[model samples]
Target chain A: MAVTMHDVAQRAGVSIKTVSNVVNGYPYIRAETRERVEQAIAHLGYRVNVSARNLRTQRTGMFTLAVPELSLPYFAELADSVIQAADENGWTVLIEQTGASREREAEVLSGRRRHLTDGLIFSPLALGPDDLPLFDVDFPLVVLGERVFGAPADHVTMNNVAAARAATAHLVALGRRRIAVVGAHEGEQVGSAALRTAGYRQALEEAGIPFDPALVGEAGLWHRSTGAETMGRLLDSGVEIDAVFALNDAMALGALHALHARRIDVPGEVALIGFDDIDDVRYSVPTLSSVDPGREQIARTAVELLVERITARGEPAPFRRVVPDSRIVGRESTGDVPAGAEGRVVGIQPGGVEPVEVVGR
Target chain B: MAVTMHDVAQRAGVSIKTVSNVVNGYPYIRAETRERVEQAIAHLGYRVNVSARNLRTQRTGMFTLAVPELSLPYFAELADSVIQAADENGWTVLIEQTGASREREAEVLSGRRRHLTDGLIFSPLALGPDDLPLFDVDFPLVVLGERVFGAPADHVTMNNVAAARAATAHLVALGRRRIAVVGAHEGEQVGSAALRTAGYRQALEEAGIPFDPALVGEAGLWHRSTGAETMGRLLDSGVEIDAVFALNDAMALGALHALHARRIDVPGEVALIGFDDIDDVRYSVPTLSSVDPGREQIARTAVELLVERITARGEPAPFRRVVPDSRIVGRESTGDVPAGAEGRVVGIQPGGVEPVEVVGR
Candidate 1:
């Protein structure tokens, strides 16, 4: 059974308006009357009816966060940060898993469920530049990631190209010449895959290393299995690689498994690095080196921007694109481990990616 | 800007009632009128007012899924499955992260935000048997995991004790006698850690091996870091463990890392196993052996039970506690690799935990 304010009011021998006033913290209420109402409220276990209040105010006190998938550690951690940020802003989050489907991503932006929440934070994976017009919907929407660029909505994203270049450069700086890139998409340009691929080529070009197309392993889904499969393919193809850079941490971790399976010594024989510094990177064997894409910052900024748009009245503010700063977190995989630090797990330094001291087998 | 039913009605040159009928798919609507209304709906980009409809229906078509944390792979995967199951039922999911705090868990059950969702599927980690009264709330709920028992709600849980025993037995079957249990809570009389520890003791006793208190590694949080710390402690203590059974996969994976760091050969010097069978285990180097605790089935069953309770009217149905089947998935960590099989990822068999045919290093 739901406890109502009326029940509390009846118990307190006060009018519903009086009870409401007490609940809303009307400072003018007599201390004695407030005390009685409060006691009744406590006794009845009454809570303010947020839905009723929201209906009158035309705000749900809720928002939708649409991500590709939660099982993926990156999105999971992102969702965690977004929820935390939303909670701090006194809002609840309803998660919508689009599964990276174009149809579902379209439905999320279609204003089909606009009345359900005050606004939406969308991360589109399948819908790219061609679907940019779909972002023209009249709703409080904040876009995430390097997809559907220049959407007419507040955008919060990481510098995928810059971060990818930094990751590649990290590998190059390790004196590894034949660096293979895992999780490359075949043909055309756009989205994270293309942008990151461009960055990888940039690092290679800067290093004066000839871009070998054979070293580029193409994979779909960017899943760990695909990463492993791609790495296995690269290894089996007899591509002499001294280092490997995967687009994201998932693929990198998979590649790590593949390397380990082959008994290849990390950082000794082949330096490795990844992007999107998910928590898994820290726990992986030998500890993975990855690009800290400022996930929490991105989430906080997205929530803040979405809330700003949701509560604003009349003239809408000009949409702005936000790109959070990202850095490379070097661990054992990238020869960043300090000697004599075996069996020790290094902790992250706030606001910076420090070279982790240890880990292995 | 939300497109209203009135906008569609105006554009279609029809009454709002006619538009409503068309939207609701009333069979009596004329084909020509329906076509005109559909065109108007598509043109105006109108969507049904779910909030308005919910207000009248007194149901939000949403449910809350409260887990400890999403950053953990187990919870992330569970949340994914739960979201999928909820989606299949046409219900939106609102996720609440309790952070495993007793106060937050209590607040979730207090019905303070009851109107936000139709029901709750809570997987509590903090609140135990002493908090039984908290679960007596009137809302539709489905309790998850080995937390408080006999709560006045439908429950969907995995058999923690049995699953843990099975995992330990698998290690014993591999001729491991000096088995160390990682992630045990000291003096824990209830909950997962306790149940799993009991299962470990049972397996050891059954195997005619004496239980060693020194082999019980206590960890507060069943995190990967904690698992690593515990395993490191156990190894440093010179406990002479021939096997390790981490309570869950996160800790097991962590323990795996610790063993790797120490150059301890898994399934050679030490056999290893874990519970919950999170996706990480499959991707981990050497591919960990773990208990497949029917996580997907648990999610599906919990959603099914909660929805039944939510939609039921009048007299309440008898509370049911459904503990799904669980089995051991053996991988390289337990010497489950088949002959001459390497450089391949093993796929899971439906409804069964198959011995993985390959993995490495």
Candidate 2:
């Protein structure tokens, strides 16, 4: 059976012109009228193929993206890339921060606001399976982040466990038997912290090394200060560790500051590694080694998925779980040096067993 | 003549209960219906004294705040303080980011979305006098930032000129005869850049120092990298500056980085100061001195003003222009120290003129 615009108009109790207006983004339509038309379109599974409709309607030349917080450097850099990508697409992006709150996340999902945007790339932090019912929202919504499970919307995220495992493996490869993990959530069953912790254990198990409970330092917030506090506490508790893995760059920076304050030589006394290859890591004191979580790919894919959903309304595509690969960035902090280096050599103590193969020069 | 609820209901063609729902934030009412009631209330100039109405509506328990971007630390900290202040008032804050776009700013001004929250504290970066007509929005809105002029909404901003002047005067007070300015916009007549530039000139005039055009560095963006680039360019151009006043902490950081790269000694050879007392200032190598722009006060006052208007219906209270005070924070980079504090001078050189009036340690 073929679905038609007339059927949608009848179901929505709106004129065909009103439906057209809603589709075309004519701003004068009342909010309620637009909401009704959108609901009808969704109910009827009506889609206007954008590639074809674009010739007739002309491109609005706009893209919409929503994230948790911009203040977080990772997200800020991600936004910078997204804007760059959107620029390449000849589109300008409108950004919204959801603050990772449930109510706000729900509001973003509701297609009621679709009239204000062409489509949305949403990165939700607080929404999960219990809120899956809200995925029926009428607009194109591409979800990002690891907080939600079985999300009805298309999603893009990083390979959290694999990446964490690889990061920990890198430390183990450096012959560091005692590695401390920062930014561990004490009791969370899900989320990035838990997955990363699992990956840490996997790496340790694979290496035939014992995972010490005391090596896991808990940081409630992933801020730099939290990282420093966690490190300080670990030191205060007389925990001896050769390397530290901070869950994120900010925490890693805090750890670096704490180590510096205590005059602990990086890559000699303690090797420091951080996740999230944030821009500042390139210029930090002993340039941090980190995992590039493919943030750029996530942003680009999220946008593409949202656009597809917006253009293919009736076609119910299966939810997507995109796991972009991660790579370890070797730097001074991880004792990576190229031939003919111009700086002083920070000697490491002998008798520390080296594991796996070292790739860095 | 006294305006009554009956008159408002008669004009709006809605039941008194509907009006009550609109006033009380009963979410079930359709957005359009709520708008009509609000319009009627505004047209009738009815004022709902919040303190008086608090007895009836026990839920003055939430407020909405909108800023341009949360990724910027300044706005992030501002939002944090605003949330804290609202919490102190027994209220939760709902935050939204406009990405500092004019269209989004206009959308916030239009009362179309007022039903979602009781009042709005809007920080506009893109809106200006040309958009003043939109300021006639019916709901309570308190505007934050220096971009918009003559807006009917209440405004909260820093004393940019005075603060910048004071910052410049501090450099002069330290016997820096040739001071440079970073983060200057080339030809802007308004905005923070222009205001701060004016203050710089005022300080030079008072100090009897000739303003050197070559000493002013223009940056494409206010980011740290841009500040560094601008500083590098100024140095390359052979401008002999004994001091620097960066417009913001970001630019100041860039300047610090640039100075470090050039092997220029801070405080001893060239003193440095910055605006916006951002948290990062405390962590910089030579710890930056900056002006505290009273952002927390601005956020709190903006919320208070919006709440006042929200409860007041459409009584048209006089627009408020809140100018938050700024104070100088003296730090290592400024070469100012407390009396009787003698320490081993490692990298710091002697014979630098000291500025006594700086407040920071």
| DockQ of every candidate | 0.26, 0.07
Give a tens-digit lDDT track for model 2, residues B1-361.
5675556667898755467668767778898898898999999997654433432243334556777765566776787677766656655565666667787777776543444456678887777766665564545677777777666567777888888888888888889989999999878877889999999999999999988899999985677768878888988898788999999887887787678666788878889998888766654546677888887777777767766776674334667677765678777678864211211122211111112221111
Candidates in order have lDDT scores of 0.80, 0.71
Clashing pairs in 2: A70-B71, A71-B70, A71-B71, A337-A361, B330-B360
Full-model lDDT, candidate 1: 0.80
Best by TM-score: 1
TM-score of each: 0.77, 0.68
Compared with the true structure, what per-residue lDDT tens digits does model 2 show for residues A112-171? Answer: 344444667777777765666555444556667777655455767778888888888889
Candidate 1's C-alpha runs over 4 A off are A1-60, A88-90, A137-139, A311-317, A338-361, B1-61, B313-316, B338-361
In model 2, what lDDT does residue A111 have? Answer: 46
Q: Measured by TM-score, how close is model 1 to the native structure?
A: 0.77
True contacts kept of 1: 0.52
Q: Give the alpha carbon lDDT tens digit for every residue of A146-181 in model 1.
A: 767676678887777777777887788888889999
